[model samples]
Target: MPMPATALQEQLITAVRQNDAAAITRLLAEGADANAPDGRGFTPLVLAAYDDHLEATRALLAGGADPNRPVGGGNTVLMGVAFKGHTGMAQLLLDHGAELNARNGEGSTALMFAVLFGRHEFLDLLLAAGADATLRDNKGQSARDLARQKGNDHALTVLPE
Candidate 1:
């Protein structure tokens, strides 16, 4: 079972959900745990990334949140960034050492999400960062296979040759 969240962590999560960068900064300064997860396993960083709150995401990262922290369903922060098509947030996570090929519970990598969603902007970034295009999901579908299934020809071109 997940540990109960501290009041400060809850407040920080609220700031993240609201996309309140200023509030996030203040809470971080007050020594709130940037890596603390909400009731559903969403860390402040993951929440900010999922919401496309770039500034709030940055604040959380600066506050020492783990960029590789797993959120809902064992998806990493990079997964949220990729799923949301937030290329800039993806870059931020990459710069902070988020695993390029980290797999979620379904064994889906960030590159797979980029391909599945046709997030071409993130495709190049994930590819260049060494996201293994050949990594297969639980369904035995590689990123290339997923792109092909989705009829995302452009994404297929970005995958490893």
Candidate 2:
């Protein structure tokens, strides 16, 4: 049988989903698992970053959230933040040791997503964080290729030459 969700785990997930930084802090202080994955394979930090909750992201990161942990579709917290055009959040995760070149199940990295979505600021942030511009996805498309295909000249310029 599948294991049931522990009360603390459920509470932690709830606090993150609701963007309650205080509740998350209290739970962590009381020994909650900061890296625990919910049903969707997303840790609290992943959800907070995806939801653009900078405070919650900061709290979880401070409490030791695994920035490299992959969630639904094999995307990491950095990927979610970058894809959503949250440059500040992306930079924060990068500074906290997020792998800039991390690839998803389909081999798409955060840089590729940023360019494909026309998030120039995020693309710049990812590049500055040392994401490999030459890295290709499952379809063999690099971030530059995606940017060119989408007519995102600003994103194209952010890529390494």
Candidate 3:
């Protein structure tokens, strides 16, 4: 049988949910697995990214969480950062080796998410970081296609046609 979650693991998950950087630090120091996923496969890093908790995301990354790990729905932490328009968090993940072209379950890249969500500020950052503008999602929609569909003409100005 799979072993149950340790007390520290539970607390670490809780700390991440609460955005308690201090508690997360203590838990990591006390030997919690920074990469441990909760019931839904959400690691602390994923949770932090989803919530736009920059400091907590940084701490988890520092603690060795995999930036590429899919946190359910085939979404990476970087995708969450893009969805939330957290350019700094996305930059931090890139610096730590996040795959700029990593696709989620739907084959949608973080660049696609940025365009789909109308996060104009993230477009340049993602492009400069090397996201593939020509990449297609499961629906065969490129980031530019999504932008066109969303009527984000400003994004069209920069994304490939």
Candidate 4:
């Protein structure tokens, strides 16, 4: 019998972790689910974005993977990429329809993570993308408030007053 589909999907997840773009494409063609979760519960898209695997990410996105898949706690690929500080990957995700305003369980958007992590490139990118910086978190803290608490002067400088 052929390999189980779940098993094939597991291999696809592995291919993503290995940064094997060719294998990712091949596996996708062979009926593997691009959204398969790894042993640790992280999906291929999540792994690709987290590791800044641009080619792998592109392949996955082309294969119809969800750019907005929730990693956990309601956080999405864009949020993770925001913290990773990869503008290209973040832009790719955004172009793929990733929501700039997706919130974590704490109600924080990608813009909030960019501010908390001090990812200035992402800060500018998010601001330009019209992210709702005025949105608040579970503590009722807006991105600007979080910036103030973290002493993120740069974020404050660019965030609308």
Candidate 5:
């Protein structure tokens, strides 16, 4: 039988997903796992960061959510923030020591996802975090290549030639 979700864990997840920073703080203070992954492998930090919930993200990080934790399909918090175009959250993760060049299961890094998804601001933030422009995905596609393929001119400009 599948393990039942704990009430505290469920409340924590709801709080983060809803951007309820106050409730999140309370849950964390009560010893909830900030890094707990939901059914989709998405941690509270990842969800908040993806939703641009800066306060919630800050709360989770303060509570010890592993900034480098990988979620759905090897997607890190950085990748989620990048895909969602949350530059501030992306920068926050980087400042908290997130791996800028971390690759997902598909070998796509946050930089690649930012470019492919047209998240120019996030691409810029990732670059500033020292993400390698030359890093390639499983298909051997670099961030620059993905930008070009997707015709995201703004993203193309952020990439190193």
Candidate 6:
């Protein structure tokens, strides 16, 4: 008999957390729903990309994971990748249709997160991918403003005056 769908999904979540791409792929083939939120309300793609599991992220995307799915505080996988300075993961998320300006509950965009966390390296990639630099958080802080506030000199240098 086939493995129960719920069991496969649970195992798929575990594989993503473990960064086991092969297991993730196999579980998806066995009818795991990559978009299904686990008990924690996080989808497989969100968990994989947020944790910087590149291969696991790829497998989940291949299995039809929605790159735009919101994780906590309405933050998407791209936001997490941005904060962590993972260019590869950010690029993959972008290629998979992650929204550039998607905001979290605080109305902060991925660019803002990058600047806030001093992940200045991600600035160019995010801009090149079409992130709106003018977007402000709920506090009305633009990427540049956040950079200044956070004392991110590197980010300030990259951002325009």
TM-scores for all candidates?
0.88, 0.89, 0.90, 0.95, 0.90, 0.92
lDDT of 2: 0.85
lDDT of 3 at 23: 87
Q: Between prediction 1 and prediction 3, which has the larger lDDT?
A: 3
| Tens-digit per-residue lDDT, 119-157, candidate 6 | 766888898777888887888889998888888888888
Residue 106's lDDT in candidate 1: 98
Each model's lDDT: 0.84, 0.85, 0.86, 0.90, 0.85, 0.88
For lDDT, candidate 1 versus 4, the one ahead is 4
Encode model 3's per-residue lDDT on 1-161: one tens digit a residue. Answer: 53345888998888888888888898888889999888777788988887878778878888888999887888888898888999888888999999999998899999988888989889889998778999999989899989989998878999876
Ranking by lDDT: 4, 6, 3, 2, 5, 1
Clashing pairs in 3: none
Worst 10 residues of 5 by lDDT: 1-10
Q: What is the C-alpha RMSD of each candidate to the true structure, in Å?
A: 3.8, 3.3, 2.9, 1.1, 3.3, 1.4
RMSD of 1: 3.8
Best-fitting candidate, scored by lDDT? 4
- Write the residue-wise lDDT of candidate 1 on 26-107 in tens digits: 8878778898777776778888888888888888887898987777778998888788899988888888889998999999
Clashes of 6: 0
129 in model 6: Cα distance from truth in Å?
2.0
Q: What is the lDDT of residue 29 in candidate 2?
A: 81
- lDDT tens digits by residue: candidate 4, 1-161: 76789888888988888989999999999888887667777789999999999989999999989987787788899998888998889899999999989998999999999999999999999889899988999999999998998999999999987
Worst 10 residues of 6 by lDDT: 115-124
What are the runs in model 1 whose C-alpha is more than 4 Å off? Answer: 1-5
RMSD of 4: 1.1
lDDT of 5 by residue, 1-161 (tens): 43244778899999988889899998888778898888877788878887899989888888888999888789898888777788878778888889989999999998888887888777877777678999889988888888888999997777878
